[model samples]
Target chain A: MHPVAVVNANGASPIVFVCEHASNNIPNMYHELGLNAADKISHAAYDPGALGVLRCLVNEFDAVGVYGTVSRLIYDCNRPPEAASAMPAKSEKIIVPANANITPAERDARTNAVYVPFTNTLADIIAQKGGQGIVITIHSFTPTYFDEPRHVEIGVIHDDDPTLASACVTELQGDGSFVCEINEPYSREDGVAHTLNLHGTKNGLQNAMIEVRNDLIATPDDEMKMGIYLAQQLRKTFKSLGIDLNEVSA
Target chain B: MHPVAVVNANGASPIVFVCEHASNNIPNMYHELGLNAADKISHAAYDPGALGVLRCLVNEFDAVGVYGTVSRLIYDCNRPPEAASAMPAKSEKIIVPANANITPAERDARTNAVYVPFTNTLADIIAQKGGQGIVITIHSFTPTYFDEPRHVEIGVIHDDDPTLASACVTELQGDGSFVCEINEPYSREDGVAHTLNLHGTKNGLQNAMIEVRNDLIATPDDEMKMGIYLAQQLRKTFKSLGIDLNEVSA
Candidate 1:
């Protein structure tokens, strides 16, 4: 199976959905990157409920979805090749043994095998939409990191271009659904905005990165609820931005 | 005028030619970034003859060409926004007054105005070519830097992936025309491979960066000769790579 998976590749919608941390399943070739069974399925491997939310949103808008099929521990699709976190030697407190002091050739192998296909398919799909494409990346963070609790439930993040994110934050806040803020938890300075910077702001695409607290999206039903609510808010976001959804290549 | 110029946007060829430092004309809005007339047109502002060669190659193979239309002093499209050289305050000996002490907002303005459009156009064009795209970035460097003389006439450079660069270097050396060497003059370690790494290696495209001495390509006629020779060698390189030119798009 390919490291990247695309759903509704020819979807008519102008919106492109990306889930960089969609799976915790490491490929057999990686041998779980030297992690134990429990640690392999940890949030470090993938965003626990992000894929479920992405699927619902893809169906909600008939948007094209591109997601990672292998563990981000192998290669984080959101990171640039030069970034250390792209293939982290230490993700949080857990040390990734296989990633420790990896050679340049070994690093290139993972990048070629995983990051390339994921990004190319995304770039191709967005190109097929011409100038009307909007990108929205979904992710979920742990309720706590390093014994510190994160209060922000949803993050509406943007880098460089804030048109979509500013509007989404307003819509999310107005809805009173959950605690939402701009650039909370992780910002562009944190090196978490690689996807938003590369595919969205760099391409002049109206884009936003949405992060939900994992506790809020722990189950399939929760994912469905969050996805439906977020979709409504996003639709309203476009409207507030003076964009006509009906005319936006649905 | 747009910061980026795309020639033959719908060309059937599988090659996407990029000239990041194509022009030395800073827009009126920038006021030449506080440089004098001579300094504004210096090799530091833009590559002297890279665009000429790129145009010749684009015509030779009917390949799509995406080039920067503004001076690199305003924003180097080849460098990422976070890179200091993207809008360098001090380029060689000339200090750019406007770029010095620039705030984040000021930086973002230039990135949005110049870098974003230029990269988006190139990325879009490459995506249009699908999986068969080959990226070749054209650049020209000064014969001397910081009072030190250089001997290499043409530098064939690569980053993580060396497939295309190695093949092209072998072909260039076999021809016995120019002093061509693999990763000569400047290698990936010199931070000159941003374009090659970002748009080329990151996407898994067969890619190489060709750097010719500015003195060698000073005239339009010289650019044409160099272009024709490089094009032929690239054709041979593709043949050696087991890629049938006839089977490729165009």
Candidate 2:
């Protein structure tokens, strides 16, 4: 199985689309996190419908897109390597039976087999793309976490790429249908700087993480609509910033 | 298939032994990283003999040990959540066919399945053992890396646990048989801080990562002997520091 899929537009454009929390598939071997059929269908097992949206976004824009294939529980693609949550996370207060307790040997094996290869693919994609590309990571967040209602419609996160995040925030805010937040709902202070830090900030690539409410794109139709909407807004923002979207494809 | 294995003496010992790179076994489905049988047995797929050494140490010291089951390449358990080498790595100068190009959903699945749960287990173990305990993370390093000969005998890595590291350094230095260096082989500057920062300094737990040369403990006999030697040294240091090694059993 290909650990990463890339749409190398190979143009002179200044944007790269990345989807970090895109998949929710456990290897058939792991089998539903040791849960029943219904539990497998729960939000705990997958990212609801991030794949459809990302697919649409990649198709609409001629940009390089990078994503992972295994479940985050296996190894969080977005977290730094040293963070406990980076591997065997306990977030959302759920216990993943497949990772409940592991031997050091087992941990190293999974890292070598799955985690390392996935990131390496991203790194290669970025290197091939070369300079002056904005990295936009696509993700989805639960509307209510821990049963607490989160009112923000969208969260635009950035570690230090405020230029792009601010521009996106302004464009998003212009849309009355959504409440645009700059690092709202979540902040980099929590120490989740994996894909963005590595592929974006580290390489001086302008970047931002866009989190849409899961319920908003839970279906194919919604995913497509949301994808087009985001693409248009991001594209317009890039144009205003004097960045040619077509140049990113070169 | 227990993903992680927790082994404790169940007698008396407050020492928590952590093996970061213990195992390197891939699932039978992965098929030795898509290589032939000869390549599978190479250090590429495994950590050589880290597990054997850890087992010997656990058995000899009657200590509580927490190990990760997945490979480090999937998601290095020792790395912080933000480190670039954390998850879904794709390029290690060699291609991992099984993880060549994956989707976003697959990445999340891996994180949820392997990364999150494993760290949670470590956190839970620490919590269960209370705040007063010594955390010793065991790891093995390649003797020859990138075709370069490494001369350091062992690496006693620490970020803020300088007291413990110093004691270890002093002990190793005193032994004339081995040319022990304090941080000569490796240092936190090379990303070792990823592990010590979170589990050790952040939680105020005394900890250090012990890197043994893989060549020295490649055999069962060598592993056992090394395990005993390390355990004795640790026991003596703990006693001098007025730390109770007997409080680690659950």
Candidate 3:
């Protein structure tokens, strides 16, 4: 499989959805990134249910998606190439031994092989949408972290330009069907908003990142239901923000 | 001036010279990277005499030249983006204060502004050359470092396929007028081979990087002399290697 998968290739949905930490399987060349089988499947390796939710979102909206086929531990597509954790030495308490001593050239090779393609594809898709390309990324987080319980059920993560996300949070709250907060559990300062900063703010496109609690999206039906809900909210949110999404003719 | 200066933009000479660490001035945006005036002019900032030699080579051969106009301390164009030294924190004993704590997005800003243009310009030039481009890079280093004196006058740097550099070394040695060595003071393992690997070897083009002693190229006359000598030797070397020089029309 390619390093990136572009769903609804011709989908002209102005609201482009991106799922960076979608896959947990490390590419064969990385040899599972020197992680044990359990670590490979852990939340540290990926956002377990994000891909399913993203696929549904893409299908429901006939929206475009750019996904990383390789695990984020090898190269986190969401992080900029210069981020220290782009290839992390440790995630939480688990050490990534393979990432500890990679040479600059080797690191660059991985960036070119993985990160570059995904970002380039995103840029191309946004460009294809012209002035209307709006970005919304989908991610999932575990209910507990480091043995501590987390409260927020859904997060509208954002960077400097928070119009899209603020609108998203407002709409999600109005629905009264979920617990929604702005930048909960993660923030741009925490290095979780690289995509929003680069693809959204830098490009002057309205964008937002959504983080769903992993437990709430544990099954396929749940993932799809949330995807459908988010898609409806996104359409309304875009309209509320004075942005019109020209749906692609599939 | 554009981020990259492509001298003789359409020159078709078989030998194409690129100068990566060609300038010492930081773009206006970087504000000299908080370096003192001395450090800005010192070897810690760039290959001082390399641009002179490159300009002369481009002029003499009527060949194409791609250059990085920003200080290496800001972004070393020769390095791959993932390189730790791409935005080096230190060079030798002097630490670069401005680079010590840059965010990934800030680092990528420099990469986007400085590094990308040079590489893209080189790629475009090579593509325009239409299958007859060969890569040759120009750089200069201090004759002494860390209280250790270096004896080599010229270093011919090469990547995996050393055909071009190996030939250049043989011709330089045959002249009996210069001291030349293969991979002296630097090698592929030193992370200096990224450009050669990407632009030369990966493109199936013959390529070499030449490093001259900084003292030898301290003046305009000195730079031009070395350039003329190298240009003449380059023509002979290309002929010896059975590579024809297709002179571009003025």
Find the candidate with the highest lDDT and give its number.
1
**Candidate 3 chain A least-lDDT 10 residues:** A241-250
lDDT tens readout by residue for model 2, A111-218: 776678878887776777666667788877788999998888788898776888888888999875787798877778866556788888999888888888877764
Residue B240, model 3, lDDT: 98
- Fnat of the models, one by one? 0.00, 0.00, 0.00
TM-score of each: 0.50, 0.48, 0.49
Off by over 4 Å in 2: A7-13, B1-250
CAPRI level of candidate 2: incorrect
Over 4 Å off, model 1: B1-250
Q: Which candidate, 1 or 2, has the higher lDDT?
A: 1
Complex DockQ per candidate: 0.01, 0.01, 0.01
Write candidate 2's Cα lDDT for B119-164 as tens digits.
7777777776677656778877677777787788677888866888
Show the colliding residue pairs in model 3.
Answer: A12-A248
Instruction: Place model 3 in a CAPRI quality band.
Output: incorrect
Residue A207, model 1, lDDT: 88
What is the alpha-carbon lDDT of model 2 when measured against the actual structure?
A: 0.67
